[model samples]
Target: MKDVIVIGAGPSGSYAAYRLSKMGLDVLLLEEHKEVGKPVECTGLVSKRVLDFVKTRSIAGKVYGANIYFPNGKSIHVEKNDETIVLYRDSFDKDVAAMAIGAGADIRINARAISVKENNDSVTVKYRDSGQLKEDNAKVVIGADGINSVVRRDLYRIRQEKVVSTLQYDMAGKIEDERSVNVYLGSKYTHGFFGWAVPGGEIIRVGTGSYRASAYPYMKALSKRFGTNRVLGITGAGIPIKIAKSLFTKRSVLIGDAGGIVKPLSGGGIYTGIFSANLASERVANAIENEDYSQLRHYDKDIRGSIGVELKKDGFIQSIYSKIGDRSFDRIYGLISSEKIIDTINRSGDIDYPSKVIFKVLIRNPALLYSMWK
Candidate 1:
């Protein structure tokens, strides 16, 4: 039996396998897709902190600021020194998978995990590869599968969170400002969420997500507004909005979207997923070395303690947006477009962790509270 069996080959699974392999654990990474990255669903906008895990060679563009458009055609521009990179997710996933393989973890492609059964001492993973069914036993099982996870379904019975439907298109066009991303805020455009245009090397990616709206019409409208002609590629996926009720059981754990750790506001999961995976690896290693599978519970506690508060706060903010209309957003934008608020955001804003600077901004402009709450 292997020390660990990871059920997905995305960044989360690959990174967890890499970390476990580095710790000298026997790890097997499985990928359902034939290739590591294909039919990409993410916007691939990542902060510099992601560089610590993988070295990316294909950078579509870099964003140093954001232009937030309000309902009434008014906009607020926030600039920062730290830049966010638009990655080619295909290359990024391959890079992480290569790192895992280099660290002695075995990777199998076209292997889809169908079910998982936990015994007292070990866990068995049933999978199908090339039309052949196979089973593998591991001291621990880590489910890094995407939003629709079989592993999660097999291990525990918990209430699943709502999934946000997203649609994006890669259009052939020249963006006015490649260094800045554009976000459109209005119920007409995105329902409760927002529409975004991210510049790539030769194409601009325009997309949107919402809990109660269809994204295709919004994406089409955004593409028309951008005056883009050719659509090079299109992809869509369901993003989990809430964290899972339980992240682990006795001998099995879920990471990444399977754990529903995707950021509530931005729908970004790479950073949080990797963060959870890193924490899981430590606990998994300890569980294996000591022969006590209960140590896996630490992974759940650590993830919740580290990111649970942020997720809850973000969810609340999203709920506020969902309840309000366009005029309310315009009023809120009028209050936040000031130099003081903009300067504060430029100085302390973060895409991954917005709560860090949100409180400070709220403290500076108390009137904004009245706008949101009232």
Candidate 2:
């Protein structure tokens, strides 16, 4: 039996395995795909804080700011000294998994976990490997899987309440400003979410998310508005806008998208997921070494104490953002487009903790609150 079993070799899983194995624990990392990060679905835009978690070489491009467009044709520009790293997501996943393997964690590719059963002393995972049935036993199981996680569903009987279906195309064409991303905000473009155009080196990634209907039509419309529809590649993903209520059980815990540990505003999970994984590794190690399985509950408490505060705020903001119509968005944009508010945003805006700017803006211009109410 292994000391720890990490399902799904994404950044969170790989990082957890890497940390535990480095501590001399017998860890097993499993990947369903033959390759580590194949069928990439992410826009790959992440903050520099990701570097603090893992040193990587999957950088594709960098942008220093964002241009947010409202439905009324007005926009707000926010810039910062720090740049957002556009990653080659496939290479990024491979890099993290390599770190785990280097740290003595055994990894199995083409391994799909079908079911997980938690016993009093250990957890058993049944999976299909190369079309053959296999099983592994571990003192603790960490479900670092994606949004549609078998471990989360089978073990916890949990499901995401609301998820945004997104679609994007990598278009080969000219980009207006490669230094900044373009954000289109409105229910007209996307019902529950918004549209985005992120510049890569040679291609611009154009995508949209929808809550009421298909995101394809909205994405196509967004690509048309951007004036570049020549496609290079296409990708789609589902983002859980709400965090899961239950993340830990007797002998198992879910991390990353599986636990809905993503940002509600931006739907970015890398930083938060890996951050939780780091915390989880400590708790898991302590539980195993101390032989107190109940200690695993602290992982949930630890997460709620840290990023959970930020996620809670972001979720409240998203609830309003999703329900607001184009008129409200236009009004909000007009109210916040001032030089003073822009400066406040530029100073406080963080991709990882986005709600900071909103609070700061409200504090500076209390009129914005009345404007929101109206």
Candidate 3:
């Protein structure tokens, strides 16, 4: 029996497995896909903190600022002293997996975990490999299997209040400025959400996410404006904006998207996933050393304490933005276009946690509070 079986070989699972193995625990990491990081769903845009955490280098390009467009063609530009990196997600995932393997964690590809059962002493994970069903016993189970997680389904009911449907296309073209990203905000493009154009080294990734299913038309229009139609690939996925009611039950725990740790505002999960994975690994090690599985509760408490408040604040912000019309968005753009506000954003804006600046900005300009409240 393994000390812990981590389902899903994404950054969260691999990193957790690596950490647990480094602590002299037997760890098994499983990935359903034939290879790790296939059919990339994320836009691959992440902060520098991710690269620093994994202790690896990123060959991807950097984005210095964002051009946020409103429905009336008015825009707000926010530049930052520190830039965000456009990650080559496939390479990033493989690097973390390699570290896990180097730390003595065994990884099995093409292994799809279907069911999980927790007993008094250990948890049994049932998975399918090579068309054959198999089971593995472990003292603890970590579910980093993503938004539609099988482990989470077996353990508890995940009530996702909203799931953003995302569609992205990799088009062959060169953006005018590779150092900045473009964000389209309007009801016409994405109802209750937004669209983005990220510059990859040679190609631009154009995508949109909305609560409504009809988003392709807007994406296609945006693509045409770029003047290139040579499509390389297209991918679709769901982003869960709601946090799960519970993250652990007895011997099993869920991290990453499976636990809905994604940022409610930007729909980014890389940094949060890595952060949660690190905490979960520590809890796993403690539970195993003391031979007491109940110690897993600390994992829940720690994660919630760290990022829970941020998620809740972002959720409220999302709700406010979702209800506003395009004209209201223009008004917001006008308010944020002030030199003082823009300067404040440039100095304090954090993509991973925009709420920090939002509160600060609101406090500085009390008049702007009417725009959000009214």
Q: Which ten residues in a row have the lowest lDDT in candidate 2?
A: 220-229
lDDT of 2 at 290: 97
TM-score of each: 0.97, 0.97, 0.96
Tell me the tens digit of each residue's lDDT in model 2 across 340-367: 8899888888999999888888888887
lDDT of 1 by residue, 1-374 (tens): 99999999999999999999999999999899999987698899988888877777867778999999888999888999999988899888998899899999999999999999999889999999866899999999999998888788889766466778898988888678788999988865686788898998788888888777788777777778777567888999989888998999989889989999888888999988888889999999999999988888988999989887798788777777666778778888988888988999999999888877888888998777788766
Which 10 consecutive residues of model 1 have the lowest summed lDDT?
Answer: 156-165
Give RMSD to native, each candidate.
1.3, 1.2, 1.4
Instruction: Give the winner by lDDT: 1 or 2.
Output: 2
Clash-forming residue pairs, model 1: none
Alpha carbon lDDT at 263, candidate 3: 89
- Cα-based lDDT for every prediction: 0.87, 0.89, 0.86
How does candidate 3 fare on TM-score? Answer: 0.96
Ranking by lDDT: 2, 1, 3
- Model 1's number of clashes is 0
After TM-score superposition, the amount by which residue 221's alpha carbon in candidate 2 deviates from its true location, in angstroms, is 0.6
